[model samples]
Target chain A: MIRFEGITKRYDQQTVISDISFEIEKGELVVIIGSSGCGKTTLLKIVNRLIRPTSGRVYINGADTAAQDEIELRRNIGYVIQQTGLFPHMTVRENIEIIPRLKRVNRADVEARSVELMRMVGLDPAQFLDRYPSQLSGGQQQRVGVARAFACDPEVILMDEPFSALDPLTRVQLQDELADLQARVRKTIVFVTHDMDEAVKIADRICLIHEGGVVQYDTVEAVMKYPANEFVADFIGRNRIWSSPAFIRARDIMIQTPVCASADTTVMRCIERMRTRKVDSLLITGENMRMLGIISAREMQTCEDRGVPVSRVMRRQFEKVSPDENIVEVLQIVNRGGLSAVPVLDEAGTVVGLITRSSLLTTLSRPYLDETEAATS
Target chain B: MNLFTFLVQSAGEIATRLFQHLQLTLLSIFIATALGVPLGVLISYRRRMKKPVMGVANVVQAIPSIALLGFLIPILGIGEKPAVFMVVVYSLLPIIKNTVTGLSGINAETLEAAKGIGMTRIQVLTKVKLPLALPVIMAGVRISAVTSVGLVTLAAFIGANGLGYLIYSGIRTLNDYQILAGAVPACLLALLMDFLFSLVEKMVTPACFKQN
Candidate 1:
């Protein structure tokens, strides 16, 4: 267990992290989320003895970290940073072998352990072992960072926004991979991220830090369901509206059976399908049932040749949003991009449904209108 | 001028003279590195001594090589002692500066990571800090070496042998080729030392730092 007892870090007269106290249980993934300069990183550094607290004690396992040799204390903890901090010159194998080498482990053991760590982090040893850090992508670099942290086989790992540098898709993928690695390895991890969604997604216990001290530290379900104060409520930000659409799948949002037309179908026939269904557009599918285009009412009037194939007259370019995307994200995309409509695509890139501007507007406006109506009533 | 006969007569004398100078310069550099590296490490380890120790090195550097050699001649007398002493003094700045810079410049995170893994102070210094600092220290050694080669040539005035003898002999005889022979080899020696140490620096440096 790692315990922070009355940890108060001050620079001159101003206090950065004040009287922060918490105990992280063994093998638990505790995530700390806060805005920049909230002292989350400072707190992690203090725990690892990188920075000493002005007044407090960090107890690792049972011994006070401050009293012990700082260097020796640090060797017992694994640290991962947002930049990944992989030594640029060293190969993946060499980077992983650093700690082991420092420990004066046998050469054979270091090599074997390096291979094991590479495998554990999901990088094939034979392929990536000799490759330098610069050659790896951001996500791959982070994985190497994780591998390096675990190189010494320390029981506690401190991750400071390790995945923040990655793209959203890659971030989520890595998060899941990390979760799996954590479960398998069962190392006690203190993960720091400003992104609350990531904390909720991966944290065994989410510690919400505001103004240096932890405002709330609890299970994800509790934090999401019952925030401690207005600050937490605001920080968590009306996650209901943000998270509501995540429950939705592409099939649910999509037109179950779209008014589809073949490439050979005349533009007039496609228009007839739109008219019959009272839909604004009819999807154009190819021989392989791939979504080729959408024949809309606008296209019918614009096309000079009404008898032309629907594929020829239909608008091929359109915006798209995944149904699983948060309503907040969808609204942002619609408003920011000035998109009139977006096609919701499935995993196969097949157009499942159309998300129009009106639908998004309605979705966004519904809560405010309902609140206003309730207040009036 | 009978330059051919002059060259033939001077060749054997110059070769033996050059060998002696080269040997002295090389020996002095080897001793300086052996002593300077440890002093640098000691200075780096102790925060209080850093400024003072570096200040001493700076003072040594400020003393002109020729002046220092002349000053040392009074104490040690004209011979290898004064020459070697002067070379050692001249070489200290680069070796000491590089050692301190190289050791200090090691990534704080990497060091922290080393300590986090429970490495003792000696372990960190030997396993992490020393290896990481190798390239920077080698760079310093290279500088010291080249400087020593050039400075050692001045030692001929103090009765130390080597290429400096050619320049000294040329001055007495008014022989230009003798001067050229000494001057060219000395320049070449400096260049060669720099080139060799550069290769050593590259080899010792972790591949990550090479690009930058």
Candidate 2:
């Protein structure tokens, strides 16, 4: 874990970072984001002791970084930059093995580790190991850069817009790969970038900064749903969440008070409740709000017996989602199953909310409508 | 006698003077590289020293080769010492200038990455900065090497034995053949120095810098 205690930095008279404080838990991938000149990079450099904070202490796992030897401290943390700073003169294998060689690791182990890293980053070690950095494409070079960072198995990895220099297609590919790699390795990673979409795509928690001060440091969902202020809302943009559909969970956009009926409720009563609530479906529940099944208005319209309980008429084997399931999966289930309404169930099988086709449509189009409202108002 | 007959007859003396001229040139170049490269690296880190050190080099370079020999003769009497000293002083400018340029001209991003990766200051200089700057520094050495060949002929003025002795003695006697013998060989030696250093330059250039 890394904690920044009231960190503030000044250059002569101008303040770059002002009294910022936050703690990143171990194995968490936190992305620090801000506009250009907002000191996001400075904040990252301080953790590695490349830029010393004017005041305040940075503690890495209960040890004050200010007291540690800067070189030794840096060796224990991996760093990757936007420019992909692989030594041009060194071959890819040599570049990846630098830190290990510096630490005087066994030569054979370092070589084997480098080959494994190359394969981990999705580069073919046999073909790429002997090639100079100049021979590799930009994306490939950054891949080697990433492999080099992981060469020593450092506890913390600091990535300063590592993928920002790549083209859009390569950037997305690397982002997905990095997210996958982070999941498997679970390193404490602190990534800094100005792009909100990139932050939302991979960050476990997004640290939003403005004017050298943190505006909000929260999970991706919270930051998207409840932006701290006008600056954050604008910076995050109205439609930013839509770009990363995975952050949009069923609980976030589902209708909270879905028209629900007891399993023993008569089919006629269920139809009546659906009509009054202006919903096309009724979520049939058992004791303690346990979701049993769902009955659509079409099923009610074709019912032969008006007095039959909803349990007999309701469809049990229907698509359902957990509250935490992302909207993308929800959309896929809805699209594949031809679901009119999908009940969101929490633990204990209780129906917490309902995501209807209409609700999904409104949530998808909210950003454009908000934009239109803003322009006219 | 014609220049060709005079040259053939005095082949033995020509060969002896030529050997002395080669020694004088190589020794001065060696001394200059030893002193100049470190000075250049020093000034690259110590910004305050760059202007004064470069100023001294420029002033020495501007001095006529004969005047430099004349100045050195007072401190270290005539012969190989003053001759080599004159050539060494004259060659310092290119060597020092190129070293400073090469070291400073490395990409800033590359150096930042080097430091960011936890290399010590010395490691950064030796591993990243110097290797990248080798070609430029070698270019400086090439310039000095070629110039040293011509400069060493001036050593003959301080009574250091060399091809210059042949030319200077021939000048006093107005012997065209003797002057041709000395002048022709010195010109060829300058070209030879340039060719030799160019080969070293190619060999030392890193693979990444090579086109194919």
Candidate 3:
């Protein structure tokens, strides 16, 4: 855990950070979100004593960081920055193993740790271990940066827009990987990024700063549902928030236990399920209860007339979404494909629920409705 | 007599002059690198001192090589020492200027990363800054080597031994073969040293620095 008390950083006549104070709990991923020059980077540097605050104290694990030797303090704290900051002279293995080597860990143990760390970050140890930073792509260099941070096994890690330099696809991929990696091996991470969307994806708590001050710092759910003021609402883009719900998942609003039948079922059975559910289509569940295809009543009628199984008539190319995905993506799929609905599958590939177009419209209009009602009062 | 016959007959004298030329150039360059590189690295770190440091180097470079040797002769007395001393003064400009430029040219991002990852100031300089700056610094050294070889030919003025002695004596005696004996080898020596230093520069420079 880390705590900042009355931290104000002034550079000559201009103040970089103005009396900001906050606490990050253990195993929490706190994102410092702001536009560039909002002092997010300056704030991160203050944590590791890279920048000394003009006033106030920073405590890491309940010890005043100012009292500690800067190098000794930084040695136990992982610091990653934008541009991947990889030592160009060092190979991937050497870059990852640098901290351990600095700590004077045995060479064999360091090599062993390097292999493990590379695997943990989804890099192939055999192929990339001996390669230079220039040899790898931008994303690979940042992954190596992450591995280097974890090499020392520091209690806390600070990342300053680690993914900004990467392309969009690589950025998204690395974000998902980092989220999954953090879930498995939770460290108290303080991430700084100028992007609001990235913060929403990765942060447990978002600390939105503006002009060297904290605008709002709270759980992502709270920040979305209750933005505290007009500034917070405007800063997070009011239109986007109102239109696209935050902290929403497919499973949260999906109609549970959608009408379904086995893929091997006859057209007669598919018709019965569709009639009972008062729907036009029947979700055909295949092996392991996964949604294999959709059998429309029209298709089922054709199968019935032809005296064949529903599997022979069902549409096998229907799109499905994971349970944890946001409703924005679900609506996009529905709108783009002109589909009435899409199945929501859980991690096991089981059809947990169905996302209908009607369902999305109802959910999307509630915020505006509430605003209208609040205005009347 | 032909140029070959002249060289063959006076081969002993030519060989001695070659050794002396090598000795004068090499000693001057050795001292220049030893003193210049550190001073260059120092000036790089101290922003306030850069103008004054570079200003001194520029003035030294502006003095003609013969003039430098002549100026040192009065203070240090005419000999190999005065000859070596002035070459060092003349060569210091390139080595120091390049050293300063090389260190400054390193990516600021790389330096920041070095510090962020808990590198001590000394370690950052030695491990990151210097290795990254190696090619540029070696470039400076190469410049120093080539110029030193050319300037050592003028050492003949200060009673120092070199192939220039043959050229000076040949001019006095109006002997064409002797003039070629001194003139040809001095030009060849400069080329040879340039080639060799280029090899060294390649050896010391990391492949990463070469690309950018």
**Best lDDT among the predictions, by candidate number:** 2
Off by over 4 Å in 2: A260-287, A291-320, A331-342
Model 3 DockQ reads 0.40
Off by over 4 Å in 3: A239-246, A249-362, A366-377, B209-212
DockQ of 2: 0.69
What would the per-residue lDDT of candidate 2 be over residues B1-212, giving only the tens digit for each residue?
Answer: 77778888999999999999998888888999999999999999999999999999999889888877787877999899888888899899999999999999998888888898899999999889999899999999999999888887777878998899988988989888888899999999999999999998988788999965
DockQ of every candidate structure: 0.23, 0.69, 0.40
Deviation in angstroms for A243 in model 1?
2.2
Candidate 1, residue B121: Cα displacement in angstroms equals: 3.5
Query: How big is the positional error of residue B128 in model 3, measured in Å on the Cα after superposition?
Result: 0.4
**lDDT per residue as tens, model 1, A1-377:** 99989999999998899999999999999998899999998998888877789999989888888788766666668888854366665688877887777668899988988889888888899999998887888988889889888888899999989999899999999999998888888989999999987887788998889898999999775676578999988898754434635433333344446567788899888778778888786677776556777667886878888887777777777656675775556667777867666667766667667677666566557657876887899
Q: Give the fraction of reference interface contacts each candidate recovers.
A: 0.45, 0.71, 0.59
Query: For candidate 2, lDDT tens digit of each residue in A147-245?
Result: 988988999999999999899999999999999999999999999999888998899999998888999999988999899998988999968887778
Give the Å error, residue A145, model 3: 1.0
Interface RMSD of each: 3.3, 0.9, 1.4
Classify candidate 3 by CAPRI docking class: acceptable
Put the candidates in DockQ order, highest first. 2, 3, 1
Better-scoring candidate (DockQ), 1 or 3 = 3
On TM-score, the stronger of 2 and 3 is 2
